[model samples]
Target: MTISTTRKLVGVSAAAGLILALAGCGAAPTSNPTGSSGGPTAAASFKPCIVSDSGGFNDHSFNEAALTGMQEAAKQLNVQFRQVTSKSASDYTPNMQALVAGGCTYIVSVGFNLSAATIASAKANPKIDYAIVDDPADANNDGKTDAPNIKPLLFDTAQAAYLGGYAAAAWSDAHGTDKVGTFGGMQIPPVTIYMDGFVDGVNKFNADKHKKVQTFGWNVATQKGSFTGAFQANDTAKQTAQGILNQGTDVILPVGGPIYLSAAAAIRDSSKGTVMLGVDSDFVLADPSVKDIVLVSIMKRIDVAVHDAVMAGASGKFDPTTYIGTLKNGGVGLSPFHDFASKLPAGLTDELKSLQQQIIDGKIVVQSKATPKAATSN
Candidate 1:
């Protein structure tokens, strides 16, 4: 609808810089982002372009899920779609420019790393519709996104994570374990919310059980934990998992996507009786063998959210505020208790459902911190 840009030096050596410069001048082609309820792009003519983060498409995780959404939108809306993969942050903005220059409409960025690059490009070219997943760009200190043209897709994982924590706690206790742990892709909200809700859920379960169950990694109240620096680095995550095990935590949860897969592998090797919980996607989907041992999963509905966003873009209605994923909204939640279903007391499942409703109904608030009530002096 609007195309705006300031003189930006697209260094001569930048990837396809000359092509992008030309893209800034003319109308880009666009197609329906599959399932676009809004009819058709104004141009009735542009293709959708999406850029992937370093993890690449088919990660069976975030990137893969997002790509599916794009492809779905493309197919449903009767449009063409193309995606660029960036191996590093430097490629972010240039990739945006390249797509814009290529005369593709609606350039979409796949992850938080693309925030700045996407924003820069959005500000410069008002005509190109840009969408980013997981991070909202907040130019003002008010903690809200100031960009009217930029669309951000976000998730409130803490809510579902709490349920996941409860599930994990229940699984561990039923199996005769008491200690657990967690980690994240980074210390940012996109990832940490899972750890926070998870810790809160476990703490509540322990409090109700009146038993001291120790957990490491995420401190719900403080909203912090150890991060693996990046989500794609499996080796570091595996090491982190091993370290958690060394500290005596048997149930480990890591919320950093593929990185947690490595953590799962590490836990499978050296724990006395460790159970690994997954995040983002169902671990059982990744490995059915792990299904037999999976305690629970802190599920994020990235697939649905991304698909919805693409549909919205095609329809021409975009909301830039954070899209928090919750149990009520089905944005995030615990997966069905697959293998562990038979192992849990029947009443336990009812209790968890009741707790989930309490959370949704605002009766129980899972504090983002683990502060066990101090022992009373007898």
Candidate 2:
């Protein structure tokens, strides 16, 4: 959570001085002032903009985390920034284009759904820097990423999801039920990637503990799973959660944006002692109302990545190289068990920590073909 104050000051000073100089002339400010004090006044023209996926900015998962990062960057770096939310897939391009037309120096597009739009925008405007989450911006729809202006902020979430799955299995075992499950908002790579790792982790737990833990929603072999059709459909998500719970699942991971809210509501209403796992951001921190039902979260650290990207762009150190979040670099990992930590079986937490290190050291490989590949070279 520590940010470099010197770096922040540097960016702020330059941007602030530009604003002051412009103010000295007859030109009016282009955007609202950041209202930062003492250090320097940020230039209204050096705005950073963000376009959310269909889930909007308050999805309480992926989109919210990214928006949080942008807000942090705006505050710490003393930059003016704005955001546009997308209500549907059709809104992606138009939202991004609006930000581009608004004269954003750096445009961050949240989620894989915006990949095509981001790639097209980056290609059309090479002068503006773009950062996209989830997808690598494979312009041709090929597996390889070739866009030089689009920086892909991806996560090896499988690493963290594996830890979460193991923890969930142990929790279920302690509860005397060997059933756990996971579902997604879509069958896309980002969503399936979490399910893949969760399944593997459960399988690993079964092998290590000699337990017959069963996962209900996702089938790793066939790459098929239950999905709510879209990220924002709480009713469908609730129905899906109820179905999984009916199958005796004591723990469930919902790998969608705000869909976790639906899962939380289901777990709460059922009153069956069932727990839920979260994705993208830590649910306990992001949605405290659901903390009682949330066991742990597979954190993608999207906010940190987005904040750092903004810092880099503001300081003129923007690199086109893709940023891959992994357990090795603190980019992606498991969140604290919170209220459930003390309730966990003895030695379970230690085992998860050891597994994390093992994965980082390459002793274990949390791989899934669904994982989006980072560019070998920028």
Candidate 3:
């Protein structure tokens, strides 16, 4: 008996619709249908495959999430998984093609950087099912890819960031240093989504309370300005954090992926109320010494996503086009505050929870360019 239920978590939400169209019902089958580390027992009928971005498989961010998802599917569906980690952008085409050539029934390209290559690879082979983890090509925003077989996973991170940002801004108001800062890995929409959401959350929090908290690299009215590209540089991130620190910005939100390490380091060493907000994976543990200086984090559920996609292909449910992961569906959310729950507000936490429910229920919309025009704003 196959049982499925869409659990709408109040604080959680990805791409199930698109994948359902690609695999069809006849792809593969296995006795053990839910993966749990037993390894694949059968080859099944359809095989699922994934090609990593230049960050490789263990970047502790998107790539890692994808791997976790695929592995889960492999165990549960008893389907074969072919995974290739790319060392550089040049490896995208070759790695993607290698999976296609290996008779993969479905192929997933891990990031937006692989969009062009996924397109060419899909067009060349008309029968294969293809997918991209972030950003869809075609530049038309027309809900169509260059190839009919490809599917895209686009996340509405603006919602998640809103919660995170709201928490950050409120934290500042109570502990009033009158300033905050932000930076991210890249300027691409995927990266920008985090920045945009962060700005929106901060603005909303301030607006509700009627305060003018000066922001570094952020303006909610026009939605612009941020700093330090790349998630790998410690020095640059440190310098950026230090600048915000000098400006009396006690809270520093750095969406710089793993580079948040630098920001945490600076916050811990500082004497003032200096603190850090993280993105993607939790940086609280990334540097436990800075636990006191750590704030909140915005998260994307990439691990579960990869696992489900691979399982979809194996289960014969792959569909093309874009798969949207939003708050209502349990694909994105805000991480716990860990040790900082002490200085946090009890009443504000309840308000954030209410906002999350309202946003997901169509009763309220957290401002985002990606959101549908019809959704009401909070």
Candidate 4:
């Protein structure tokens, strides 16, 4: 299948409509509410709860996306929901335990850092249904990646980041620069998966166009890259982005939640016409302040996955099947160019579309060690 054909197959218009509808879903409750206003009362017997990582619900990334899903499920399914925010790594277990103690019927833990705690909780409370975002909840502490009561929401983000990288490279090349760069919040698999695919996409662009585009902040061979010590430290993220910009990078991809805000600030303040690429959630939609600087976004569709999982669990069809977001499944993809659409070089958009199709068709393989294999039925 070609790029145009793929778009037609995916029903881009319909997807956009669904996204807009979801955007209008009731905002996530700041704290646990008894029931949604103007919506049906949730059955007291069924409660869906979420535990956010340190990023919190307003991080405008994966954590926020997961919460958004829960909120939407509350509105659509008439299910009561609640959420807990983790202030630090130590809070994972306590927060989860608190939710369990509160009689949460299904608990969803966001982020991989909570894997061990989530696994332990799932094992200890085998009767309660559980789902984890961005990880396979291995209940037995075994290497094999599966658990009967836990659903893993994983995304092949490399597939989408690859497209973002290619577009960034093309944009850089068009502007008479061969410099692009990426940085992460941490070195975890979920974070590095994006950087790995980005670097590879830049390499692919270099090879296909016979141009020498340079990538910074990440080295696939060395398995090393630049990172902010913490996900929520905007000051550190800004400093890192400024340092990278000083090195002459005009296209920057920050593979963290709100850290991209720092990069956006740096780009805006530098007055260098630099652009940014967002991860997990579309920064353009999540934060209007960064819309001008975000050329495109590597969307992970976490909200959709979360909503589907909640619906499944509510309808009594919950299973251990891992939901792997891939290009073929509309699980991950690049967002519309938005303001940057008209600014791209001639044919650059077409080139990106073609590259996406190539990846989907197996003509181009976007691989990362962090890529999670689909779960097998036991």
Alpha carbon lDDT of each predicted model: 0.65, 0.78, 0.65, 0.78
Superposing every Cα of model 2 onto the true structure, what RMSD results?
A: 8.9
What TM-score does structure 3 among the candidates reach?
0.81
Clashing pairs in 2: 16-41
Which ranges of candidate 2 are over 4 A from the true structure?
1-45, 141-144, 376-378
Question: Please, what are the lDDT tens digits per residue for candidate 3 over residues 1-378?
Answer: 001211221112232221111111111122245555664343355778888876666665677667766766676765568899887778888898789779887787888778889888888898787767775655445545666777666677788788777888888888867577776666566776777777777777778889877678666556566566654646887777666677778887776455566776677677776777766555454345556677766766655555555655554566553556666665567666777777786677777777677677777677665442211111
* TM-score per candidate, chains pooled: 0.81, 0.88, 0.81, 0.88
Q: Per-residue lDDT for 278 in model 2?
A: 84
- Estimate, for each residue in 1-378, the C-alpha lDDT of model 2 and write its tens digit: 122332232122222222111111111112233564543333455678999999888887888888877887787667668999999999988888898888898999998888888988888898898888898888665655556777888888888788888989999999858999998988888999999999999999999999999999999988877999999857888999788888989999998898888888888888889999988877777778988888888877677778778767776766877777766656666767778877999988778878877887799989987776767433
lDDT tens readout by residue for model 4, 184-275:
88788899999989989998888999989999999988888789977875789999888878879999999878788788888889998999
lDDT of 1 by residue, 220-254 (tens): 65665778887775788888878877777777887
Better of 1 and 2 by TM-score: 2
Backbone N/Cα/C clashes per model = 22, 1, 19, 0
lDDT score of residue 74 within candidate 2: 83
Please rank every candidate by TM-score, starting with the best: 4, 2, 1, 3
Give Cα distance to truth, residue 248, candidate 4, Å.
0.4
lDDT at 31, model 2: 26
Question: Between candidates 1 and 4, which one is better according to TM-score?
Answer: 4
On a 0 to 100 scale, what is the lDDT of residue 279 in model 2? 86
Q: Which portions of model 3 show Cα errors greater than 4 Å?
A: 1-45, 220-223, 269-273, 283-293, 370-378
